[model samples]
Target: MFTYERKVTYSEVASDAMADVAQIVRYFQDCSTMQSESLGMGIDFLAQHSHVWMLTAWQIQVMRRPRYFEEIVTGTWAYGFDSIYGYRNFLLKSSRGEILAVANSIWILANTKTGKPERLTGEMVQGYGSEEKYPMVYAPRRIALPKTWEDLEPFEVRRSDLDTNNHVNNARYIDMALEYADPGVNIYQLRVEYKKAARYKDKIWPRIHRENNKLTVALCDKDQKVYVAVEIATDEN
Candidate 1:
C-alpha cells in the first residue's frame, strides 16, 4: 500500500466547507499516480512504451467528508491483475485514522497506438506487488442504467476537462454528473462506468434519473450512446 498526507484546501471543499466527493476521488487518483511514478512505471514510461492505463470503473463510498484545512491521508494499492485488467483499492482517512472514504477501481492496460488491450506480464507488475483488497462491499464494474431518464442541457467538453490522455478525466465525469444531482443530498456512495472517452468539443447530452435517495446520470452523445454512467446514493431516501 502507498499513502500520502495533505490538508484539504479551500478549492477542494464545497460551500458547506466539506471536501467534495470529486476532490476525494482526485486524491485517490493522485495517490495511485504517485505510486506508479515511484515504481518507475509512471506516465512518461507508459507513453514511451505506447501504453496507457484506462480506468474502466470506480466504486467509492464516503463515510464522512473532511472539513477544509483538515489533514488527511490517502492510500492505494494494487489488489490483483488478470490478463489485461487490474484491480485496485483506495482509502481516505482523517488525521486520527478514521476512514473517510474507500474505493475499488478497475483498469485496463491498453496499447495507446493500436487501442488494443495488452496482457499483463510479470515484468509489467513486478514493482507494484499485489496486496489484499480493501474491506468493503465491492460493487460490480457495470452499472445498470434505467430505461427512462430526463434529458438535461447538453454541454461541450472543454480542454480543461482533458487529462494527459487527451480525453475527459475520470473524475471529471463525476463532476459533470453531480451538476444534475440534488444540492441538498449528501452522497454516501458513487459508482462510475466509463463507456467511451469524451474528447474536446464533444457534446455531452446528460440524462438523469432520480428515485428516492438515488440519482443516476448517463452522459451520452446525440444518439444517446453513453460516454459515462454515474450512480449516486445519498444519505436520505
Candidate 2:
C-alpha cells in the first residue's frame, strides 16, 4: 500500500469543524490517483494511450471525521483486477493511528475514443501489484432503487462540477446528493453508483427516498434515467 500524510485544511472541513464526507471521499480518490501516477499508469499515460479509468462505484465507511488541522494518513492499494475491471481499497487514519475511514472502489479501463471497456494489459498488472481486500462488509456495486421517489428541484451542471475528463467529478455527485439529506443525520456509510457521465450544462433531476436511517438520492435526466445513485446510511441504521 502507498501512503501519504497531511493535515486537514479549513477548506476540507464542515461548519462543525470536522471533515465533510465528500472531502473524505476526495482523500480516498487522491490516494488511488497518486498510486497510479507512481506506478507509471497515471492520467497522462492513459490519455496517451487513448484510455481512461472510469470509476464505476464506491463504498466508503466513515468511522470518524478528523477535525481541521488534524494530521492524518491516507493510503490505497490495488486488491484485484479482472478483465477490464479493477478493484482497489483505501484508508484514512488519524495521527494516533485510528482508522478514520475505509473504502472499496471499482473502476473500468475504457477506450476514450470508442467509450468501450478495454482489457488490462500485462504491463498494467505488473506495474501495480495486488493485495488482500480490506476487511469490510463489501456492498454490491449496484444500488436498488426505491419504488417511489420524491422529486426535487432540478440543478444545472456547472463548469466547476466538471473534472479533467470533462464529466461530473465522482465526488460532486456526493455533494449534490447530500443537499437532499438530513443535515442532522450523521452519515456513517456512503455508496455511489455512477451509471452515466453528466457533462456541463446537463440538467440533473434529483429525487430522494428515506427509509428509517437510510436515505437515497437518485440524480437523473429529464427522462428519469439515473446518472448517479447515492445511498447514505446514518449511525442510527
In order, how many clashes per candidate? 0, 0
| Span of ten consecutive residues with least summed lDDT in model 2 | 178-187
lDDT of 1: 0.92
Over the stretch 11-74, how does candidate 2's per-residue lDDT look in tens digits?
8998899888899998988888888898888999999999999999999999999999999999
- C-alpha positional error of residue 29 in candidate 2 after TM-score superposition, expressed in Å: 1.0
lDDT of 1 by residue, 1-237 (tens): 899999999989999998888999999999999999988999999999999999999999999999999999999999999999999999999999999999999999999999999998687778889999987888889999999899889999999999999999999999999888878678989999999999999999999998888999999999999999999998623
lDDT score for candidate 2 against the true structure:
0.93
Where model 2 places Cα greater than 4 Å from the true spot, the runs are: none
Model 2 TM: 0.98
lDDT measured at residue 234 in model 1 versus the true structure, 0 to 100: 88
